[model samples]
Target chain A: MITSILRPPPIIARMAFFAVLLGAWEWASRMGMVSRFIAPPPSEVVPAIGLLYHDNELVTRFLRTFGQVFAASGIGAALGMIIGWWLHHNKNAGRAFTDWFAAIAAAPLVLLFPLFLVLFGRNASTIIAMGAVAVLPPIILKTKEGLDHVPPVLINVGRTFNLTRWQHIRLIMMPASLPTIFTGLRLGLVFALINVVGVEYLIGFGGMGLMIAELGDRFEVAGMYAAILFVVLCSACFFWFTARLETWLLQTR
Target chain B: MAVANEMISRVTLYRVSAALFLLALWEAAGASGLFFKGVLPSTWFIGKSLIRLSGDPVFWGHFSVTLFEILAGFGIGSLVGVIVGLALGMNRYSGQIFEPVIEYLAATPKVVFLPILLILFGIGVGSKISLAALSCFFPMTLSLAAGVRGMNPMFLRVGQTLNLSLMQRVRMIYLPALVPPISTGLRLGFGIATVGALLSEIKLSNKGLGHAAMQAYARFDIPTMMAILIVIFALAGLGNMLIGSIIRLPGPNTRRLTKDRT
Candidate 1:
């Protein structure tokens, strides 16, 4: 089976692979081949998810976490693009900023949680700060790239048409930079979600992350597993939504 | 374009001046009490505290914990990621079967698994290292798979013609091609590794800079918190530079990858 997987797999390969995997996991747990406590079957986990959905404020917490991500991405993306555009137009500042972006990006934004905690206390505000700071760099960097790569001939034509700088930007720059900006925005969205959940987990705040943390603390293994699955599903939904948005924006072109 | 090149040439000076200017502004803001409730620390205070932390053996001990977590995590993750990436990239079928899993894991914030990691590995270095490894795995796998698939077909054809051994082909053709992505992933992994370890420590552990910072925060010791942050920043910067040097060290071919700005 492994050797067959190593070769060019057929369409059935993935379904077969997943079937074997799920079956093996369930079988192994039931037969005590692996620790059942750690590796519970999907049968238990799926039901636990439903139970939690009704028992706990799972859906509410899920939406709350989603709200934080959306809010952070909105604020961070806007600020990043604005700052990025300002810096790009000012080449000196852009150069200076780019030099430091590497160092800042290298450092984890989570380390500043102490300061953020001090400022905002144990709340969603701190989570938002964490997400924004993490999301900012990539957006700024990508926005700069987007603006920089605006085709030279396009700008030259704008000049030939006697268009002002702002006019050129409004007419040409924004549309041209949209794809790259969206790429940055997408990355920022992912990072925002990650850090939001992370901060939520850390602060033991009100969210799906907090639920997961609490479940783990209580040793509700199946519930924790369920929460994690929900988190993954939430992320997948976010990806799908953003991907659709990207295509929609492209269609406008 | 030429103007852009000229600006790039002057960036080093600009960066230094900007750093100095920001530091001076921050120092002034801090010293003048413009920053409320110890929101910022003066440069002098931060510097002195940084020096003090540098001398403290306890601080070094915690620093080592973070360092160990990143190294162990990056090393283990890199091995698994590279191998999986190699297999998946080499075979379209394997890629089909596993690539979605990789992509899904990549999108899902690996940090959400912290609870499971804590349960499985306990609230010590083990969990932190696990988190770092889990976090690093995605980037490593994705980049490596892309890198492997992106390898020059001509090189493989040449190897096939010569009927070179597998290991020889790997060394002569694959390893060199793989280095750039490996370094890219590691650099990315380094950032997340630092974040992961510090985050886990902050969440639970009693050791590491995160714990120290959190403790300092609880104590309202502003200077100490700032100092630890400086150290963390420096550690991250050093790791980034180190990974960058590694990418540069594998001769001119790899160096060009870095130079080719996206």
Candidate 2:
């Protein structure tokens, strides 16, 4: 399997594939084969990215959005962990509440942004609250699954060793569940980011989403594309960070 | 026994009471005049508005547009996802080649392409459909791929040893194997596709449920906005229920079969 993966494709071939696509896009746009308004070539978009960077609007907006996502996901993860652990100890209560919550969670929570804005106002708070709400369900569901699946023998051994309830949870339950909890956190963060951007786009505030909207309103298609590319970069960075963390955790174990 | 039954009833009453209490607090907060009236319309006004809005053709028109986009996108996405998933699962070479590309695109927010699509397709049905398709595509593909990959290799070997034709093997093995994953993908796709449609409408379109919601916000029509919210939430709940029922349908012992192999 390792050898097959190594022999699958070369970096150069991948680069070539991307380059050819870009080249064709540029050629098509310049030749008026496709409307420049619709498909602004990467040539225009690439340079526009530099301008956006120098303007500092992109950085500022990105930081604001990232801050909202981090704050919301952090709060949601902590709260979900507490709730999930509590529910683990009380199965019936957990089952009853989780069923109700999951029903609510499956709904389009983004539609509640207007209500959120009314309650919290058009500030980072509203955006953060929306993100947190969006993030909570996955964390709760995953953590509950993780805790439920902990090995019975491990719990028996812990009890035999005279470990207290707190000790059993901290030493056995938490460690056993960490990997799955982390998976939930990863999903939660992604949802949080998506919700924050959507909310920001819907109700205008200064963020990357707002920047995309502003550019679209102005018909500055290139700038809009650049802002989107920045969002993509942020997402890539998120995935990379989480993957590394997952690997590190596995290695530590 | 009578006392125990009475206590159970009391507990049920308490649960209902808690919900009502929360609603009352919301109503009280809105009526307090501490906040701007437009920002926090009274619950009384929202109830009235919901009734009023339900009868309006304009609301239905917008809802239909959003619904059409979601349904169209979901149908197309699920079909494509299942096909691609099956192809990749059956072919090791193609699967290895395309896996990274799929993963990369999956992680990227397809919403980022909204502006470009709007420019290309105009702020009409085309753009909305495109956005919904793009958003719904990834999760469907991912779920289907996971499902396909998860099929027991022993099953395939057994089919091969029996000298089963490729089409027969696919019919007997792959199609049944895909049922659960494809169902799950469809469920996830529905929600994401709805969001994609709404997002596109909110961002660019002039007509749709999202546009109605945006218009309400812009005009500070709080009750109308709340009405729209209730509608969206109801539709989402309905969609989820439909999918859940489909998943729970009695089926061949596929899960047990797969479990044995694993």
Candidate 3:
């Protein structure tokens, strides 16, 4: 066993850990140690991906969710940057309201979905707007924080070079703050996706969330898991895109 | 100093005006009868409902249910998180293997587990609590593990040199080192716990503030819904502030230690 060794390599340990977990899960499910309804074996779940694909809504739902995430994150990042920039530039406003944004970020802004539903009327707009608002606060908070923390030395150096305000901001402030802003954007995307899918599930809208909810309701356990797997894949793709973009952006500077 | 004080007052003026302007705009929108009738209730209407809600025993009953779920879930999740985080952080091989797994799980939208939890615990407080607990667990664990991993080795060495007992080392060394991460984890965990509980409640529940808000929405009782949302927001804010203040309670030595660790 890996445990008997003083120290197995991390890759070996990781693979072993997952293998053991999956094996135990399969064994337990087959033995009826866990209910089939709740814990369908991985063997069943793996094939269920084909089942959802054959239903033909899988790609459409995936695209629908992806579009909502993209639009919502764009809106949120734009608005958040503007607000955050304003707060950073105006010291007094930052003092007066930074905490408010922080507080809002901490609150479950997803709960405001009912209002969005009323305002946008049970459509894709409702989900998008809710996601955008849910994601706004973090981006705002991070933008301000990032801008505020631009090293004093860097600003002093720019001033010594007699750079114009616009040039200094564009050439110095923007690049200096890109990493933090990207961090905020990533965080905001996570929140936005969660809320978007959650709202879809709650309202049974036309997305993977709705698919998962519907499958669960029908007790199509494996299908529900497959839908969940697609959502996870979607999330992973988004995370990977941001991570690659962040790396590429940072590397250029 | 006087200039700073004047600037502070001016800032306060600006904040007040900004708030009032937004509230007035909301009132105008609500009264204009342009948008859907109940979408934007006037500030006055929300305020009246807030007052009514304050006096309503029924509101309190639902509020307490949500509150209990948040507290219980946060409590259990955080406790387990600290234990598991400490265990993983202490073990080199295990940390290398499992830290990525924990991070991956944490990043996934946890609400997707709602159906499974529902099937396991049914559509009651149990399912909601499980959701909240599940949400809290990841952040708390990640934060604590990071904290433990980052702790200065010299502190452990010093405790050993002093021949400190296990309890004394825990109280004087480990506890101080862990406080900042614990507070951060608490803040993050509690926030998500509230979201999980309320969301699960909204989706399916017999009695809770989330359920009440959904009921009001279904009835087109916009004022009541807004009032409930305000209460939820306030509770979350209060929770964050409480965690903030709790971390600040330790005296200078521990405070310095926290700063140093971070």
**What lDDT does the true structure give each of the candidates?**
0.82, 0.81, 0.87
DockQ of 2: 0.45
Q: How close is candidate 2 to the true structure, as a TM-score?
A: 0.88
- Name the best candidate (by TM-score): 3
lDDT of each residue in A1-253, candidate 2, tens digit only: 9975546464544556678999999999999998777778999988988888786477788889999999999999999888787667765556446676677667777767778887888898999999999889888888888999999999899989999988988999999999999888988888898888877876778588888778877888777777887788787787778778878987898
Residue-level lDDT tens digits of model 2 in B60-139: 99999989988887788777877787787787666666755776677766777787888878889989898888887887
Off by over 4 Å in 1: A1-12, A164-166, B1-17, B24-36, B252-262
Residue-by-residue lDDT tens digits, candidate 1, A161-241:
999878988998998898999988988898888888878888899588898888888988888899899889888788777
Root-mean-square deviation of each candidate, in angstroms? 3.5, 3.7, 2.5
Error of 2 at A64 (Å): 2.0
Please write out the lDDT profile of model 1 over residues B5-74, one tens digit for every residue: 8877788777788788988887777668645757676767778988898899999999898889878987
Kindly report the docking quality category of candidate 2: acceptable
lDDT of 3 at A132: 95
For candidate 3, lDDT tens digit of each residue in A116-234?
88888888999999889977898899899899999999999999999999999998899899889988998888778888888898888958888988998898998888788778777
Error of 2 at A46 (Å): 2.2
Residue B111, model 1: Cα distance from true site in angstroms:
1.6
In model 1, the clashing pairs are A9-B93
Query: What's the lDDT for residue A53 in model 1?
Result: 85
